[model samples]
Target: MQQHINEKIEQFFRDYEKRFRDGLAGNVDTASITSAFADCFIEASPLGVHCGKNDAAFREAIPKGYDFYKGIGTTKMTIGHVTITALDDLHYMALVHWQSYYTKKDQTEVTIEFDVTYFLQHRNEELKIFAYITGDEQKVLQERGLVS
Candidate 1:
C-alpha cells in the first residue's frame, strides 16, 4: 500500500514536470493544467485569484502568468525543490519552490522566488489537483512597485 502511494507521488511529479516544461516553452496549450486540475477546482496564485470549476479559467491562467514574464523579456524558470507529503490514503500535499528570472522592460534583470502548495487527491482511479494556493504574492507586487 505504501509503495503504491509512493509510486503515485513519483508519477504525478514526473507527468506534471513534463507538462509544465512544455507549457513554459510554449510547446503546448494548457494540456497539463486543464487535465491535472479537476473541474470545480480553486486556484490562488501570485498573479490573481481564479476560483471554481471553470476549465477556461485554468486554460487561461498559465498564459496570463507568462505574459508578465514575456513582457519582462527572456524569462527563465527553475524548479528549486518539490516535497510531497501524504495527508491520508487518498490525499497528498505537494510543496513546490521555484524561481523566475527575467529582464525588466528597463533592461534590468531580476529574479524572484515563489512557493506554491498544491492539494492532490485520488478520485475515480486518477490523481487530480483540486486546490492550489500561492505564497508571497504581496512581495511580488512590491517587487514590481505595484503596491506599497
Candidate 2:
C-alpha cells in the first residue's frame, strides 16, 4: 500500500515537473500548470500570505511570471530533491527542491536553488496542490545581482 502510494505521488510530480518546465518556456497553455492546483489555494512566502484562485486574472498573471524569469535570462528550471510526507490518507506534504539556471549578461551561468513545501489533497484519486510555502526568492535574486 505504501509503495503504491509512493508510486502515485512520484508520477504526479513527474507530470507536474513537465508541465512546469513547458509552462515556463511558453510551450504550453497556462491551464496545463493551473490544472495541477486546487480551484483555490494558499501561497505563503517571505513576502506574505495570499489566497489564490484559478481564475481569469490568475491565468493572465502566469505569463508574466514566465516573462520575468525570461527577462532575467533564466535558461531552465530543474527539480532536485523531493521529500514527501503523508499527513493522512487524503492529505500530504511535499518538500520539493528546485534549481533555476540563468545566464547573465556577462555570459556566465548561475544556478539558484530553492525549496518549496506544498500541501496537497487527494480527491477522486488525484492529487492537487492546495497550498505552498516558499522562501524569499526575490531577495536572493537581488543579492545575487540577477535582478535590480
Candidate 3:
C-alpha cells in the first residue's frame, strides 16, 4: 500500500514550491532558497558530481544555472511527486521531482525534469537541508543541449 504524505513535509514543499515559483518569476531572490540549506550541505548532482559543506562546486554551479535559466527566458518551474520519509524524530528525507521550462540561449523553449532526494534536519523549529542527491543532471543537460 502507498503511504500517505506527511502534513509537515507537505506544508514544507508547498512553501518551497511557492518560493521557487516566485524565483522563476523573478519576484523573489535566489539567496532565500540557498539560505534554507546548511552551510555544509552536500549535494550530489545527477551526474555524480558532489558539492556542499565538504565541497563548494555546487555554489558556483547553482548561480550559473539561475543565470542560464534567466538568460533563456525561463518564466516558471513546477515541482511534483514530493514524498517525505521520517528518518527519525528530528530528521526527514524528501524526494521531489522538479521541471523547469525555459528558452535556451538559442531561443529554444524546452523543459527539463529531474528528481532529487534531500536530507533535512529540524533545528530551532525550522527545517534545514543538509544534503541533496539528484537523479539525472546529465540527462537534463543533454536534453537542453548544455552538454554534448
On lDDT, the leading prediction is 2
Candidate 2 segments exceeding 4 Å error: none
lDDT of 2 by residue, 62-139 (tens): 888888888898888878877889999899898988888999989889999999899989889878999999999889
* TM-score of candidate 1 on Cα atoms, chains taken together: 0.74
lDDT of 1 by residue, 22-115 (tens): 6557665577567777667777876687677746665766787656545445366666777888898888888878776666667777777877
Query: Which window of 10 residues has the lowest lDDT sum in candidate 1?
Result: 66-75
lDDT of each: 0.71, 0.86, 0.70
* Candidate numbers sorted by TM-score from highest down: 2, 1, 3
- Give the TM-scores of the predictions, in the order they appear: 0.74, 0.94, 0.73
lDDT of 3 by residue, 101-125 (tens): 7766686777777678989887776
Largest TM-score belongs to which candidate?
A: 2
Per-prediction tally of clashes: 1, 0, 1
Clashing pairs in 2: none
Native-structure RMSD, model 2: 1.2
Off by over 4 Å in 3: 1-5, 46-49, 53-64, 105-108, 146-148
